[model samples]
Target: MTEGNRMFIQDKRSYSRLLLMLLLLTALVSSSTRAVVHAAVKVPDTIRVAFFINLGTKYQSLTPVATLQSANGLNLIWRDPQTGISAGTIAPGQSVRFAMDGYRALLLETTDLGAAIAVLKKVQASSNAAFVTQLTKSGKTVYQVTEGAYSTAAQASSALTKWTNAGVAAGVQTLLSARVAGPWAVEAGSYASAAEAASAAAQLGNAGLDAFAALKPQNGTLSYVVRVGQEKDATALSALQQSVAAAGFANARIPDAVEPYTSLRTDMTLNGSANKPVTLYAIPSGPSTVLRAEPAGSGGILLTERNKRTYRGSMEMSVLNQSLAVVNEVDYEQYLYSVVGAEIGSKWPLEAQKAQAVAARSYALSSGMGFQIANVVDTTTSQAYYGIGYENANATEGVNQTAGEVMTQGGKAINAVFSANSGGITADNAIEIWGGDNSFLSSAVPSPDDGPQKGLLDWYYVALPSGQTGYIRSDLLENSGQTHVSGAKYLRVTGEGTAVRSKPQVVSTVEPVARVGTGTLVVQLGKVAEYSDYSWIEDPMTPDQLLTALNKRAKSPITGPLLTLEVTKRGPSGRVTEIAANGVPVNVGAGDNLRGALNSLKSTLFSVEETGRYTIVDGNGTVREVPSQSGSLQVIGGAGTSGSLPASNAFFMDGNGNLRAVTTSPLFVFSGKGYGHGLGMSQWGAKAFAEQGYDYQYILKYYYKNVSIEKGA
Candidate 1:
């Protein structure tokens, strides 16, 4: 009885031990699985980009280094420091521990295999430390090239400085996703000739397979191989093989490691000769400290003033005219932070800011003309880019919300040109400014006044709050009545005179002048005058001054002195299409030239008038002569004056300030309307529209017809 009981107890103890072991194993397996899932979910798809920096001037040398006191350390490998080719990976720690004063990298990605391969080859040839990676996204292959990776975005910015130093085109972008290795491709066949391989590829492609001909070296011989489809794993490879067999390709196999086409050489170098500009790369000696450029060559390091300015990207100092030209090269989005505030007031509404951001982005990313070292200028010529000083919370928000968004037409970026106040109506692209049909930049219908009114003159009547009514010409108003309402308020005018009876009528005592004083709030009645740009402005120029300005701007030599100024033709916008000065036709073919010829007269819509006092001729010494007492003297050939000079045209002012008959040159006056080229989006108009509850998209659509706002590529 004792032996049987002992055997049963031993069996029970063994069973308990085995059960405990099984439970522990299950817990271990569950923990491992959870860790894998978490990692897969946590890994970011794209890198967090801080900003892009542009080196505005050519540099002689540059050096990048990690700050000694920074937690985040940089591992940089300069492929060609002079040419700005580098490769590095950052040890993540602080947000911006290492600061590269004048350098930034641009991560560019391409879906086009050929384009990607070309760029990779170019970078590899130019940069000794260049790296290229391939990633599969949404079942499509993408290739990416990074100039350098840094611990903090501030350090990574050195890439751009290097690129500019190498004189590379501003084609790099900062918005890029992390690259992952692509899958293996199934090779269908190999042939000695590319033409033969291409035929096979075509056949496979026709069978609904993604096929391409790639040249590869096999057994020391370059052979063109045809590939069908890419497979992520062995199971996918088997499935792809089966599909290829079914598509009539009996011999289809997946390579263990498909080598890239031989056309993309492993040792390919940059195509052109490297003309490395003089570059200087600065590194902060301590964390959160100002960066001082490491001196290179004979020139001592350009010491940047600490805390002088806070830049979003990096600062690039170059010698221009023997002085330092500090250029802040920041990322596209960061660049907009200051641009929006500088272009339009930061106090503008969010929608207006967003609209301005898009327009500025489009303009900056357009043709890349007028820029050598940087993408844009810090002025109206390109776009006002004042850097971090001008950046405001609202402007930054607008940039962030509309990040990577641009206005495009037919899948291409449009010009997105804009100006301050379109007066009333936007001008036609073909007729105004550039004299060509930019399909997207058509006339935008102005508020209150759609298109243009035929009968209304540019002049307007103003009723002042000081119990005075006066005739105010269109030019006197802040903006054209086109975008403004008839009863819009204007600045107060203390002293005023009589209001004209009607538009196109001369002001005289018969009209009854009403005296005005302080506290006068003038209000625009309506557009009662017709001229270019919705207003009439007079630009008075002496005969000599007119001739000099004209000759300076004329493409060809303007031989004669000022004689006759005539507007030969006018466009529908009332802008002078063709003009002649002194009978020698002024080349008004280009809008800019026309504007300059007219002393930069607000607009081309102008008429020239010559005026001088009339006098009578007499024998012996010239004496003062007045017309008959009943007859009034006439001032002929002046702006807005219409009359012929008398046959006795000799007239001069005597010593006693009396009129005498003597020859004298007449003063020329140019009367016109509006400001700017009168084309595209008007900044003031955009603000007005924004105030009226219009969104940025609506504002862009209104100005750019047949255009779509889409995320940037």
Candidate 2:
């Protein structure tokens, strides 16, 4: 009886096992088929990205990488190619792949295995190109064709053109390969400190040379060397040295091979002070972990000011400005995860977020500040970085999708600056701010209406009867025009009654105070200076108040009261470029400083109004008014002048410091529009463009004229 029961149970178990094996085989086949189909339709890989968990720290925990692969069901195998020995399985929460070094390869596409074999044969016959065979995730076989393995990107790029032109459709891809040991580099200079080396590198970059500061070990100590280029082979090295020499570096020479050093350090110090010992930690708190700092001696814990300050990298704290400053040294892309949200709203359109990510990445790469350690600040001075608390899902996604991407001009990172808004039009870097023509940074019309006006008669510069010179529309000129003034550099004001309004004549403010009186000339600095979204703000200051503000901000002393306020010079946007107070000429500062000087002034485009008369309206629908020439007047209304009238028209003091009226009346009005320095890609303008169905690339192209957006490393 026992033998029969055991045989029946064994047969049932065998049937179950066979069924499970068949199901597993079917799933495996289905997965392989799906991968092949996906590979066929997928775009060719352009980059091989090495995601770093901590940027500056010598030790990087591969936990994030493992976690990412596991979460995405990706099978990643790590082994030593030389020894052919298996290290171990890279499981979730383990840190293994720490090095952020890779090389770019060209992936050649083929219709089938036969086609790939044919290309490989042609490559071997035509040239000594190296080709690697591998199957893609989609189970499609492809060949990675390379001219030669190089130590530096410059050498790789120099060789890419030759292989691509060999009659093959190929795309560049990044591969995780060991760097060939090399010491040869085009040396620009060597410095005793990192700061000096960085300065030299910047100078070389300014001169259009690609240079970077590298730490080299010399005579038992480390020295910072400014390297213009690094090549593995002698031929490439010689070519670089010659090119740099031709580019004004007469002393550029190939230096002997030096051992490469990693920028990451072993341990990071936190709040190291003479009085207190250095505190070292491996990583910051995880996303779910609450942040708490322990006292130096006491075991007691103090909650961090920012409790949810999760960071992807390590941190170092130092005593800066007599206060503890913590710097988060994180991967370039992870840094942008926090930055994109802080700079622009996380809820912004995906395209807008992508644009911001690219701009932020370019900005960070071009930055030289803190290059010795973190490379950037955690505040608005660089880009407002609030760590993981400010990071959102969408923002992180944007950062991941645009990983390693940056804006480039002439094969180098461009200074991609952006602001909250451009006030409808962007400014040329040369004309508005730094005063040097950057072809990539030019004035761009963000609005369609900003284009030139049509059906308008020719404009001519003319001298008016009152001696004012400005451009006058042909229709506004009188018959006594004497055949429109010929070929003048500056536009001249013509006709007897023409005046310069704050905006174009149509839809302009009706207040006479808002318009520059007749006789003041106007020049065409740029396109028509009119913005429909122009804003207005009022800031009234008494003679004494104006004197106090001017004295506080002016580089030179501003004494006495303001006898007169006049805008002596204006920019192309009609923004005041120069102003005079009490006959003292003050050159308006560029960019944000223009508004910082006068805290109340929103923008340089403004008008000042002084009124000596006031109309007071009381509660009971009764009104009483004071004439401009009134000396001592008594209000006869429901409420006295003190409680009646708007705050804009408050009390005023006579020249003798006497309170002329006890009612709200006679106040100066300052009306203006816009905010911030109108330059580069405007945040609001980007949002508007995105809403109009324009992609981030189009928005960026519109603002940054003549710039290309390409996949970068």
Candidate 3:
């Protein structure tokens, strides 16, 4: 084609290649520049801190050490020395940080060197006794500062004294006056030549003490004396003392008691019947007290005073045992000694404190009274006194007067009870005696002061003027009054909402039989003097309604003489019949007897096959299921119109005791009798028996096996 055309093509290709190379170079340069511009900037300077004290409050002043991502970003590791509550996490933007003041130091990190310099400037501007300095002495550059350094030992001592004098508490560290050793300027190994003194000073400094040499004349030689200053000798002494105290030496100074505990004191009176004396030991500090029983060691025994006695059967003493469990009681021979000899601390010596402890122990034992104790110093005299339950156990520890007054612990109000008729005092009588219609203000029977009654109630029991042993409501009986019923016994019944009745029927039942529902959670209300038939039942209403009602009371009604029950529910039974849809006749086989077949048909079909009839009600109220027949009707076999019976069909007994065909398409009949399982009390039957004059107790016995009717608690 021609040399000229080839040359043109070659030239075009060369120019295109040159253009591509230039473009590639340009793109590479642009990319490299972009990367250099986008690379992360160098991180700046950072600061960190450590804590030196615990400031329980004032959280914001603490400076937590932080890691800096940039000037605007920070990662905080905040630690509160006071509360020991610490947290660490990344933080962005300037925000309020929390830490304990005077208890923590701030650790800071920054990317800008300028920012670090700025922070130092701020520290310098504030008079908060803080500053930053780069420690060149340490090979590694460390920022540190001198805080409140004393120039001399005398200066530090005076400073501490001034703080105490001004009531500017530095706490035990300053209060107890602890001292720390620091650099001192003193002469060591005096010599005529300054070089020798300088060498000695250098040597002492190398020994890790801040020492200096002071040249002075020593006999015939010029000697140098090396002295160390700023040593906190006081701090070491204070710390040692604290350590000793914490190691259980707080009471080591007091002499150990050599006397023995006393047990079984004589001449004690029951309920103060005869004036008696009981000796109790005073703690080492005058009026303080501790209880110990004879032959018993420490720790095992309860805090009971030695030889603290009332009487053999004193009510207060017994109650004390219940509420204030004297651990080392003379319950056994070894118990007395085991509890007495243990190490009892001096804290038990304060009489007021001990009394409070006793009262508290009593409450714990009896679950009755509530009490507290506290120490008080008479403002007028600066003397210590104890205040207990409004009075002082220590103030009058030795003032046990026989005739001062029959003082009740808290002034006995009316915590006792009296017993009376079946239902206790009627609502009318309760209102009259208690000055209010308070139902809870019921009475209890009387027993000796030392009787089994652990707590006081409003009720009591007494013999009637007529020699009746029945319950007479307590509120009606005064302190010394006597009244009784003809008879009394505890009677109760068990069942979930068990029904109590006057006549044992669903109707004519005005009151309950006594609800023994959920047989547990019982409280003794009172004894039964003579409850009428179904008189004082726990629930005097419908079974479900009564349960709902009883739960609303302040306390549940529970009495003694509880009866355990076993319940059973009756099942369905009776007889029913089925019938054919059409009155068509079917042929019977020779083996199928007519009577047997008819009996089976009686349950299988409603039609009376023997009479060819069915019992049906007509529009006019006339009964008619069978069509009028000419003569004595009977089931007869037929052909054509009648359907033939299936083969292999058999008759069996149904639940109703009726014979019928056992097939997929079968009929059911219901003619059940008896309300429930014929196991225990039958309401229907009870009514029948009651109609015959049988009493409630008689009815109970007749139905329940091996049970007796007693008064409830």
Candidate 4:
């Protein structure tokens, strides 16, 4: 059917039929049909959204040290640990005391810098000068990393020796730049008496060494010391120390070191002049169970101090991994209102929003995800369920119009899984992503899944050399006068898949377009995509960063450095089902596991390309290949730029004026289409179908095969 013709829906006849079915059900209520009513899916009046799980993660970084307060005074309860019964109400707005009960430091030993950084950020609260030290493991080039700072050189030295047999925590303390000399001299030797040092200095002077004996205070004790080489310049001092070592003074060093600087207490975060104190949970002790807080009125909304957002209904704070995991139990319809706004978004026709309501509603009911605490999470983990702030009139109308409607197959609610985009074709949930087969879920080439680039964050439409035209995500595309949609979008051409043209032409990409369909978003009938996460591009990941993503994300985390990252297998929809890290299959049971790892790329359908790889021989004659630079680097022809490379310790300033670390360069760049796993209905496609005049029922039925919209039991 033509795109223009879709405006007319395949009507299910009339609502009179629905009314008749309801009347029939009511008439049979006292009979066996009543049991069937009880058995049929019942729409919930309320749903719990696990807003924050594993609270310390960046996925929902509202607070690392999590705590929340309601302005209208909270009705608090401390549940008993044994019986899970509330002990009683507690005073509001008062500082509650909590104890540090369980805590264990996670120390990772990995191969790459990126993975190390991922763990480093987690271990040290995003502090780059993390309370971490990377040490080379014994007999292996792999890094053994940990969280902590050195208090003393002796302590630092001890840590290196005591680093678990894993070989982490190796290093001598920096000693607060002790090697720097500001009118300071090196201590050649120390003795109990000045006469002993004087005799030693005289013998050193006889050997033409610059040395003098002097009495010095050593931590409130007197000590005779032989000092050598007076120099105010740190570089000169270092040179002199090397010379001294050559002259048999092997252990000569500076003394009386102090800490480099002071930092705010661990709980509080430092932000310029203000110290953001981390709130302590009042996980009441003794008879107290778990902390629960609610606003006074049933319909009242409470604002949390932590994220500074308002939530409807009561919030229960439960402890998970020594952090607060918050669940918001809000009215079901209210939740859908926000989900529609967050998912379908505004400015997209009301029809799309209604379709979203039905899909979201059915998915929530059938997900079977909640385990007593919450039915689903607010994150993309379930669906983008922002609270009241995300609610809009258009979305509210959609939910209200399609109230209590859900898709059912075989008299049961279907798992109405959906993604932001489809990269042109939806995936069969069972086979494409999960590697299983399901009759309820099937793939379809929705006209709206143009490509990941059609409406995503950034992209480049290029005409491939093979004469096939497709869009390339921004990351893989080179700069060629690119233009992003700023004000309004225009549909230059319309077909099964919308041809969105913000402008006639702009920058394009290199790697041939993987695939294309009706990928770009459609505005009211004919306009360019306003903002859709159809395609996405992740910045180039240094080896360290890539490995960090893989390890942090993989189920059975990869232990060593990431040498290679390649998609080993793909499902029908071109969604990745297996990825090989360093040539080994990564244990990612679900595609999202791999998705969450590599910096949370939009979807499993993606591309990984190695950039600027070069082989180099180190001073130790260790030959290895590494990426060229963090950013771009100009290369010279083999015959032109011929010189010995600098030592690894040499430093250089980068384009950003920051000192580049002693590392080679970024390894891989990732780019792809689609937002979520390519499964079930594509939200972008729904919007397209709606723009084409299809009703909510038609949209849901098309995406969910053999499904009918029916009311709850």
Find the candidate with the highest lDDT and give its number: 4
The order of the candidates by TM-score, greatest first, is 4, 1, 2, 3
Q: Per-residue lDDT for 1-713 in model 4, tens only?
A: 97555544323434567778988887787344212123367888899887655534434423223344444455644433333323223234422222211221224444454454444454345322232222222222232233322222344334334433333322422212221112234566667765687566555544444455544434434356666542433456666666666767777776432211101111221221132233233231112124556664443344343345666777766545434456777888888988888887688888888889989998898876454457888777688876777889999999998788787888788878888887777876665566555566657455486633443444434332223333433333233333323222322222332332322223244332233343333111111222336654454577787777677667777866565677888876787778887678888666656777777777787888653344545457966555422332333445887443332212233344432222243357676777777778888888888878987777776777776677786
CA lDDT of each prediction against the hidden true structure:
0.51, 0.48, 0.25, 0.54
Tens-place lDDT digits, model 3, residues 1-713: 69999999999999899999989999999655322121122111211110111122321111211111112332222111222111122233222111111111122222222333444344335323322222111122222221222324455455444433543322212111223223312222334554564454345434333333332323433333433222333343343334323433332121122211111111111111222222111111111112212211121111112222111100001001001111112221121111111211122223212222222211122222111110111110111111111233322321121101111122221111111111111112221122333222222211111111223232222222222212233323223221212122222223455443322123333544333343322222233322221122111112233223223331323221111111111111111111112222222222112112332211110112111222334357955432332222222245535342332222333345443332112222211122111222333333344446654334333433233222111
Q: Model 4: runs farther than 4 Å from truth?
A: 1-39, 52-73, 76-281, 285-292, 297-299, 303-306, 318-325, 450-532, 551-568, 579-587, 612-666
Q: TM-scores across all candidates? A: 0.43, 0.41, 0.13, 0.51
lDDT for 592 (candidate 4): 58
Candidate 1 per-residue lDDT over residues 307-342, each given as its tens digit: 223445443433222122344444678777877877
Root-mean-square deviation of each candidate, in angstroms? 28.1, 29.4, 43.4, 21.8
lDDT of model 4, residue 217:
37
> With candidate 1 superimposed using the best TM-score fit, by how many Å does residue 374's alpha carbon deviate from the native?
2.3
Q: Give one digit per residue, the lDDT tens place, for model 2 in 191-280.
A: 777678766666665554445565444454456666764234466777777767776778776765433322211111111111121111
**Count of backbone clashes, every candidate in sequence:** 32, 17, 104, 26
Which parts of model 2 have CA positions greater than 4 angstroms off?
1-310, 319-325, 370-373, 447-546, 600-602, 611-668
lDDT of 2: 0.48
